[model samples]
Target: MHIPRWAIPAAVVAASGMLLTGCGKVPPGQQANVGVGAPQAVPDPARQDPSAAPSQSAAPTVLRVAEAARLGKVVTDAEGRTLYRFDKDTARPPASTCLDSCANTWPPVTAPKGRIQVDGVDRNLIGKTKRPDGLWQVTLGGWPLYRYAEDDGPGDVKGQGVGGSWFAAAPDGKKAGGEQQEQDDGDGNGGGRNRWAGWTVVKVRQHPRLGMIVTDGEGRVMYRFDGDRPRVSNCDGQCAKTWPIVKFTNWKKLKTEGVERSRIGFIERKDGSCQLTINGRPMYYFAGDRRPGDANGQGARNAWWVVSPRGEKITG
Candidate 1:
């Protein structure tokens, strides 16, 4: 699961000629509750046009499976959203469609067989599924996986649903945390949430502390608890030290694409300044996690797990 820092460029170049498959992802959780950023450039919608049909061929007859632990472990981007990539095709869904030309654009994150290990997560939960062209692909709860070509780095998720409804599979096949879900809807349109297979829906709460996002290994979108909603740091500031929420200066700085703008509200604290709290819980970072590929804060204090608006928790 660890991609060496120096070799990325070479691997990307070599990936063009090779066939690197992907694995479905998952996020780990303990008990319940939590919440979960960003606008870069609008990549060409054409490169992702699914109507074009995949120029790539189907996968080979056999594929590979990975340990569930590796898939469950995660790394979030600076925006606080988890980063997922296509395990196979850059655009195709369920099966990997990236053949020769497309493979170069996106490379699957793979380690030597048996080289990666994740603690606490069940190994049996991780395995592979067969793609139509015979390629043995990594699957999370049976769903196929892939990575995005548009993603230039390990954490960049620009390729998610690039070609339309097909999205990058999370380690659990769903997403982690509620607020984190915003990152998944690249255009900020709330509709992409429909793709989740196991995620629950929020009822009535304007912004639940826990928001739903994708968690591939579990086969649906899910939510994980970030912390008790607050501004003074009820997490003992231990949580605050880890999962810091992004502060936007103006409403214009904050763009809720698909989510209703009204659903997007700000909270002002006694401190006079403001901290963003959805459903009351303040967001933060663990610093325990370093890279976008590192997910050190899955379930802290043991009581935390990602949940959806309806309060459904995602656990592995």
Candidate 2:
């Protein structure tokens, strides 16, 4: 239940690749009391398509279940655009942590001032909470709903696991992806979050901008700090807040692809937590890198550099 030091809300996510498929049924015994709301036209200025104008009609905001490639039954808006929930947000009290700039990227699915239509989703689980801006945002199973701005149209779920927090919403207001439910592994990270079977724990990706960069399990590019000696990490405190260390507890759980298994190791931090390392260099996740394929931490301050599959620093 603890939020990380560098925790940001959400962003566009790459699709999770796995062969698993099945219909996700809502768990039983979950019931809440809330009034129905009629849908109205809510403007989303951050929409990717500038040519797509806002709807002027008074149609109800339709919430329904749809099938995703690997994520199975997921919640989508009337446009078929995938809706997501933030892991940092709370469902027990029906609160949202995504705000300001985060809200700009992941727009809250604002329920119209009046009744919403539902399919597959339990209407009893549907409700609304007043955002700080005084807008009535839609909520499901007490968890607020949101839409990824980068998701172009129907069937586009480009925001599946950004920042290790964002995920496609299931009909029952739980994290979607069929049988792959979020389970805590005692690290407070909810186990391999959004990671599916055959997903690599460490791998080499041919980044279009950085080329042949090392990526963590979720495909977020990893970095190495020049300030640290081999097997030691100097990036802690506020430095760690900006570049969170790659943490792991079990060695057997670390999987790799295109990277040598011998190169993968770990170092105990001053905090008593084990941080994943590659070829003796400590690994990190840049807080600025919102999603997979992002190498925003590359050449940062001329000290931080993205690592390559060979466990060498990537200069370009």
Candidate 3:
């Protein structure tokens, strides 16, 4: 029998773990870009970095509703720049904690006249709060709004997970982006009673070096093997032992955003196991990875690597 290029011979499987040990180590500078669940660095607006502060433009008096490809419905300024909410801010009391440098980097959405106009949003939820700078900032559903300086134009979400504290604001004053809990359906399929249901099977994970990559429901990084074609499982026996297949119980219930549904399907392994495929390539998890967001398997032996939402391999 001819083994696929991705499949390792049984002899190599016995020592694969030892040979692949410590292969996941990313360089110091490269690791700095990986952002897991939240952002670690608090953005300092006072640093005076031109890129860190919004341009000097007229304050937007009207807020509008815009659709983000991955974030659904989000609130934007008159110019269409995405507005964000700080995780540290309290909604009940309606306060603005972003001051000085923080304010420079994320300029508060000021409503100078205390009266603001809104489009496609509930007018009742629109309100105003006093900032430390003595400016009246706009508030939606009791949450203050701000624009990210890093965003060059409208619809930029560069601050979405910055410092793990900032996120795009929803029309209802909720965080526009982040992971949600997956509910288990009685069937083996992972679906909850909520609207998320099948859509929760796949999600986005931010890596310091890899930007945004696709992850399974448990947040484990998903990988694609180069040797296999679409709907084919070339990794078997010892090969499968090192890189286990990623399988889903119900294909119809598998929901995904930012990914093409036509590229998703399954393949039968030699051992009679069903493995998941994206864009005709089989997906798997590294046996060496023990926790969520682990991409230790990336660049392994110049063959394994994590995949982007668009089904491209993240080699770097």
Candidate 4:
């Protein structure tokens, strides 16, 4: 992820807690560009090089709705850069998962002091979530807001569709993208595409990092929880939230590529939702996986692992 060059002057760093501290302007100096997965040392504001170039002025602390070419109406920071929400993050209670190195790549949009201003969006839907770092990250409709580091300037939506989990946030805090494309219903007979096509069809895709692995219609890699049993799922409540079950209906009409049809099936979840299965083990989608081809969920918690077209776990 690219580092952001936007400045916030006199921005006060409050102590660690989940409370909205008074928002302040950002201080001067470059918001350090760090390598992904490695922590880069940031300069202490107290000590600085006098000859260092000054940082740019801070954009007004306003959240606005802008029309994006691909995603239509999207929430943007005062700078007009596309704001995003992570699927791994929750909204009902409001939380964030993009932390540390992730934070460096996708900086949280800090909450403004006092009431927030908006344009072409419902201000009542705006709220805030206290980050682990004590900063109150702004939330629209309970979804935390963020700015992509790769977006060099306003109107850049490089962060859209990243990791398949990050998306340009809609004004109401939903995923913002153009009208859904028609899906290829597995059988030759063409009916309207299933609204859940992303989780409906299975395929064998060549992931740049994970090699040949099983994926859903949207090309997101699939995984099986080791703790689960045949035709059963132990993931529920919070666990279910993190690893959303592969939901599908009309198993008979399911599509596949490189996957064994005989090995495919479905298990009824406690909530009565149908979860797609391979060789009896339940399938799931990891919240951490932001986009297609991402295998970030592999080996998670020594339990979750990617699946292969053969319905076998991909280990090693």
Q: Write down the lDDT of every candidate, Cα atoms only.
A: 0.34, 0.67, 0.66, 0.66
Per-prediction TM-score to the true structure, in the order listed: 0.28, 0.42, 0.43, 0.42
Error of 1 at 26 (Å): 36
lDDT of 1 at 43: 41
What does candidate 4's lDDT look like per residue over 1-316, in tens digits?
A: 7422121111321222111111111122212111100011244432243323112133245888898886788999777989998754656456665655577788888764666778888988888888755567888877788889899988889999887668898887778985332222222122354444333677776665666788876677889998987766889899988999887555334655556444566654445466777877889999999977788899999999999767899885
Instruction: Kindly report which residue pairs in candidate 2 clash with one another.
Output: 13-158, 13-159, 37-114, 37-115, 37-116, 38-114, 38-115
Candidate with top TM-score is 3
Q: Write the per-residue lDDT of candidate 3 for residues 206-288, one digit (tens) a residue.
A: 67789878777566788998877655557777988899878744443465433544445554444444556676577899999
Task: Give a tens-digit lDDT track for model 1, residues 164-275.
Answer: 4334444454532222333231222244553322222121211223334322221222223533443223443445444553232334233221222222223333222333
Question: Which tens-of-lDDT digit does each residue in 132-235 have in candidate 2?
Answer: 55557788887789988899899988999886678999998888875344432212223555554432277666687777777764667899999988766888
How many pairs collide in each candidate, listed in order?
72, 7, 9, 12
Name model 4 segments beyond 4 Å from true. 1-60, 179-316
lDDT of 3 at 158: 87
What ordering of candidates by TM-score runs from best to worst?
A: 3, 2, 4, 1
Q: lDDT for model 2, on a 0 to 1 scale? A: 0.67
